[model samples]
Target: MTTAVAAPFRFFSLQVVRTRRLGPSLARVTFAGPDLHAFHSDGRDQSLSLFLPHPGQPEPAVPVELGWESPRSGEAGSGGGWWQAWRELPDDVRAVMRSYTLRALRTGEDGHTTEIDIDFVLHGVEPGSPVQAGPAARWAAGAAPGDRVVMLGPAVADNRAIRFRPPADTDLVVIWGDETAVPAACAAVESLPAGTRARVWLEVPHAEDVQDLHTAAEAEVTWLVKGAAAGPEATLATLRAAELPPTTHPYVWIAGESGRVKRLRRHFVGERGIDRRRVTFVGYWRQGLTEEQLREQG
Candidate 1:
């Protein structure tokens, strides 16, 4: 029922082949489908939109045709895009849409995708948790084999959705991400070439959420646990006190809560004197807002 307006992004009908719990706060779901023949991506921080059916529904209720212009209004291209059509769907009938990062994918001998993985952060899924579980978290917590879903992803290997880009002259790769961004950040770091220098800071809600990253790069990684030394103040303090290796050109990529991302960006550009053009900051979510509210504000 969720529709993306971009033609470059196409819909893929997928089903969960398996699921694995990564930690107390994270789970990995593997999906496969015939529609993956057209799915392609370079994979670094690749962004995707996923659609899920309501409880008891067999499949997501998407429109048969996502035409750019609706002719029913008796006007020429005045109706709006596919997003409008998706919004017009009844609340109970509409699919639950969530944004996720592509963790990894496997290809067949013919170079067609055979399967893909997405890691979900299970926020509020634990018993007696203070925060309430959102639909995506709740769905991911109980996702099982044969669960149907839909994804809006790239048809081209290289697209704008893949944002972890560093210039040719870059000598140091700096990364910071919270639990919500761990999947993308891990994928990006793991793909770095040998001899590359990197400094990574990954913050997770629990100690169990910390993961061992395998990378060819000479990377110094630090994991911060929430109640111990995570969050905006502690994270910033640690970064501020630490010393980075000498490098003429450094590229920085940070994603997480919007407010924290902004403060970290300022620390890199304003305090550390790194070039603003060399930094890429993404706000995956805001502290006090839902995805729908964030989209509406945009």
Candidate 2:
């Protein structure tokens, strides 16, 4: 007899209740919603689509409601509530969509108010980048108790076609990531079995970029400072040179800029001879595209 596999849950939206600076260039936004109750916390590395309103708009219309059972096709929902507000947004304002990770999730006693955290990487003083350091940054930078923004995401986790279930006796793991993927990489490291030998390579712009991370496994971390040549391609070369135990079963995860991730994926699976299943490669962001744009390109 054959058992049927359950269908994966679809994505949904949340309301940003607050936002704050986690570090110099990292902004943490906290979101809440009923849908979060169904979110799979074990899939921490997954990407989420975030919908932000036009700068001056007071209230934004809501898009379609998403859930485990929601049908895949439909016009944006028609209610005059949050959903309507989003539907009526001006074309220019409607165009602003960003992608971020589900950094962490907290389920309360009643499972009603799930707090989801997302970190936005501030890219200098530019205006167009998500979480820029300009005027809009002030909004996110100083967001307080009552401020709110529309959020839609926690898209299904990227389960690579090649799977590697680390053996019970496996000794080591290696994780490499850029700022865009720090949350996911950190979460993966934290979830590993206790006493598992692990090494984490993180590439960030500044010294303050190194936050106090929480992880359960024994981890030796290396931080790559993007000083002179801060491009993603340059950083990957630096990280690849760092050595790991060749004999140990190393489950490697590398994620970040698209170009760099693509190159590393080729090098590891093609040249280095590591089984494709042993490595998870994700392109968290591309050089010149927004999160939504990145999705469209993919």
Candidate 3:
């Protein structure tokens, strides 16, 4: 059933329509649902919460809480209502929740979303990998057509979930993201208008993860291949030594590992002297912690 969790965002039951391997480390999954007629988004770095079922479950276990007077009221009950109830579920029985970005979407003539694409970063899924694959990565790697799932996504075209916003006077757009944030960064880049100037850096574990980005704007995109080292030192060194174009009004967007995001944000605001207000930074995930652990610490 479709449950309205909050205004501009709600739960929609969806099924996997198809899956495509984007690269060695990325997989693209497309989903569709009858209720997607209500799914609306402007699509620049749109954020979403995906709930996946465990291996053999027919669907993600999400109990809809309809006790509120208005689902759009933006208030939770004493125990936080559905969130609390869901949390109270047995660990193995509850749906696996993960935060992701909308990579792309298509609409019909009536302006209803017909399908949406999300790019999943596959980690440790390959044979004999050093790191263990996460739940979402494993689910995505073997995702097949007709796999059932659920999504908490935008119902408003211009919602607060979208973080990329360049002022009208912005002369330059600077962007950086690791593999996890590549989908969001790419969405922001693809949405750039004609004649806009942009510079982007995308870091990935392997060279095969490099993607060909298509944009109308005057954009210079660089793909940084990470070495065996497990930190952002190499990325930071590259940014420090590179030269940027002269622009008084520049907007910067950086996302990826939490620690690295902070470092890059500082480099832009402190080292490059860009206005902090003009820079948008997001930490998609932490290096050593699982998503559930990260949420718990929050």
Candidate 4:
């Protein structure tokens, strides 16, 4: 659903203002453009489809018409509208469409949007190479101040891309994820109302990868890193050893590897008796598979 591009969404041409390594495996790229003034989001894990250029291209490839809607033709953005039209273009022109969470956003007092930050995981396919160094990682690793790309993001304050929707009766909140889910968890945590009770567990690749976190909610954060005797098994060990609060009205959000997320979901729903509907679980990516492969499977 993050890749859904349609009305209430439009193309925004953005230029990179700067890029910095946030941690050993994370890079934060700040983007700015005139079109960003209309970009809006509700902040909780909001997603956008990025159009990154091929290795040597100056600008990202896009259709000349900039996708549009024709309700008279009965085409929705998914079935026969944007998705279909995008598919009809040449493979090289369509480029690579990847979904990403909005890490941060700033607006000026004059009411104009100033900047938006997106964090990219410096992962590659091989160990010591990053998590999985594909085109996005390649771009981020070498991004200059003026690099540009296109994205189909929110134009309204509240849209469907935000996947973190907790119920009104929710009391305790539990969120966990690997490095890829950090941006999502980061955005979602700050949205919690003040005094809300929440527990956050984040797993990254390095101890230096543990960055600062802020939240108005009563949050307890724990960082698990690779090679720190806190790998997957260690995560399960911690989960099994801990005592969680009562779960009659609990809300849980889990993301990362498909298998791990499923395991956590079962633990909460099967063991903890949390309502299945109260859990928002997403597998951002799967091990041994790329985003393109996942899309094809979907």
Candidate 5:
């Protein structure tokens, strides 16, 4: 018999409190749950597994109370009425689940009500695309004030943590990412030592995706457009090839689509011979996988 490991944490039910449009393809959904009291505040780019009920299903089951068993068990204690039916579902036809980042977090006065923000990338009508005009996107775009969903995972350890405490003599720092990786880049920038010299590169599908970021370090910012001839790797290569001040320390951070990020990581750590410990590289998302799938693969 397989022994089940108790989930390190429990999931909470949250209602869609609000929604905001960040871009033509990005929408932010805010949810408030009582379980937020246990959330680790420093988690950014961390993923949460969202359990969305099937269309027309009366309600969703609570993962914690039901344990980490598959939701296919039917509504909790509804009798084995639908349990056997749910168990008969094909592996691929099960209810949909998606992973998304914790873009922002806020705590209520009593610390019981916590609001968290997550962005969903709208993939325009592409068949098989995770964000295609399907049930999940429809649910997110039209989530009602009282509609409930299950939130699992803060997945704290999954993030690539970077701690940068450069020596006083250090000089230059470079950070770059595609829009999906922006949260991590922002977190890294905010954590850098005061007065550090840095350059930031952000790539997005359109000009409007750019947002002003505040940081204490001395820095120059650049925005690159997707589909432009100068891809992220080329852009980073150009910057890396430039002459630098002798005392500048190079702390490089690059993340985004898997292919592009892998290329940049190789160039910086292999060809350029930078110290491995001095660079932080993360593959935030891949070109063609849902965030949940990525987490499973990892």
Candidate 6:
């Protein structure tokens, strides 16, 4: 009998089809598979779950004891299938699961996905370097054409992970982020309506990391390159000194280092007097802390 999977962690098999370097620090990997036709996306800031393999392991193995019930057993329809199931896994096993935004998603006239692009940061590896780094980054660095991985993403186009929500009457949109947030930011730009206007401040490790963004919205983007100024000190200085255009009906989106996100939140709500209701803030990552560590601390 075919099982109707109620679990959000339902797996969809995919394989790498190609890879491209978008900038000095970003590597774009394209994946394709038959199951992709059911891989729905909400189009803006849409992120998905990826399961990568440990070094020396060809594929991921989610043990039954870890609470990841297999669809084959028709047991995936049970209790909290994300974190609760995750908590049951060994720490190293849990570390292999990471979240990533869809840089691009394409569907064919036949209503099947011809391709999907995911841009990965080339982190923790250097010329003649050892492979001690995040599992996801290591996997992407070694991922070749035909390499496979599994995803737990949207089964329907409308899902909660697409967080770029602004009221219809919003006349101006403000966005900010660092390299890690670039995929989501660019996706937001792509989602704006034809006449939408936006001011975007994006920060990256280097100027070469900046790439062209495609959008119909009238946008002015300022690229912030990280230098000697530590923390959000440089970005905070720039944002404080800048003369912002008159905002009619404004909506703000901010995501980056947790510390920076906090500062940005204060700047908008405390200093700029923007209503707390008009903003979406996400802390993608933090310095010296892994995602799991943050969750545990929180």
Clashing pairs in 3: none
Which should have the higher lDDT, number 3 or number 6?
3
- Tens digits of per-residue lDDT for model 1, 1-298: 9986444567889999999999999999999999999899999899998888888888887653674334565321235455567778998998888899999999999999999999998988999988898988999998999999988888888888899998999999999999999999999999899999999999898888989899999999999887733468887898898899999999999998999999999999999999999999999999989988887787
Error of 2 at 95 (Å): 5.8
- TM-score ranking, high to low: 3, 1, 4, 6, 2, 5
List runs of model 4 lying over 4 Å from the truth.
1-6, 64-77, 88-93, 125-132, 228-232
Task: Name the best candidate (by lDDT).
Answer: 3
Tell me how candidate 1 scores on lDDT: 0.88
Model 3: how far residue 13 lies from native, Å: 0.4
TM-scores of all predicted structures? 0.93, 0.76, 0.94, 0.89, 0.70, 0.86
Pick the TM-score winner: 3
lDDT of every model, 2 decimals: 0.88, 0.63, 0.89, 0.82, 0.63, 0.77
Query: Could you give candidate 4's per-residue lDDT for residues 40-121 as a string of tens digits?
Result: 8888888878888887788887652635443345432345556666778787777677888999899989776789999998
User: How many residue pairs clash in all the candidates, one count each?
Assistant: 0, 7, 0, 8, 3, 0
Per-residue lDDT tens digits of candidate 6, residues 1-298?
Answer: 8978544434677889999877666789999999887777777888777777676666665443444344345344234544456567676565377778888899999876668888887766546533346767778877899787777777767767778898888989999988888988988888887888899998886677889887899988888877435457778888888777788679999998988999998998999998889989988888888866875676
List model 5 lDDT by residue over 1-298, tens digit each.
Answer: 9997434434667778888866655677888766667555455345456767666764454334444334554233223433334334554444455655566777678754378877665555334544447456777766667777877654233333323334455578877778777655666576565687878877776677666677788877777767445565576576567554444357777777878877877777888777777776777667777655675575
- Residue 281 in candidate 5, Cα distance off native in Å: 2.4
User: Where does model 1 exceed 4 Å of error?
Assistant: 1-7, 67-79, 228-230
Cα lDDT for residue 266, candidate 2: 78
**In candidate 1, what residue range of length 10 has the lowest lDDT sum?**
68-77
Candidate 6 is scored at a TM of 0.86
Which is superior by lDDT, 1 or 6? 1
- Could you give candidate 2's per-residue lDDT for residues 96-196 as a string of tens digits? 55556667777778753378887877666334544445333445565555455655443333432112245565677777788888877776676677788
- Over 4 Å off, model 6: 1-9, 63-95, 127-132, 228-230
lDDT by residue for model 3 (85-142), tens: 7788899989999999999999999989999999999999989988999999999999
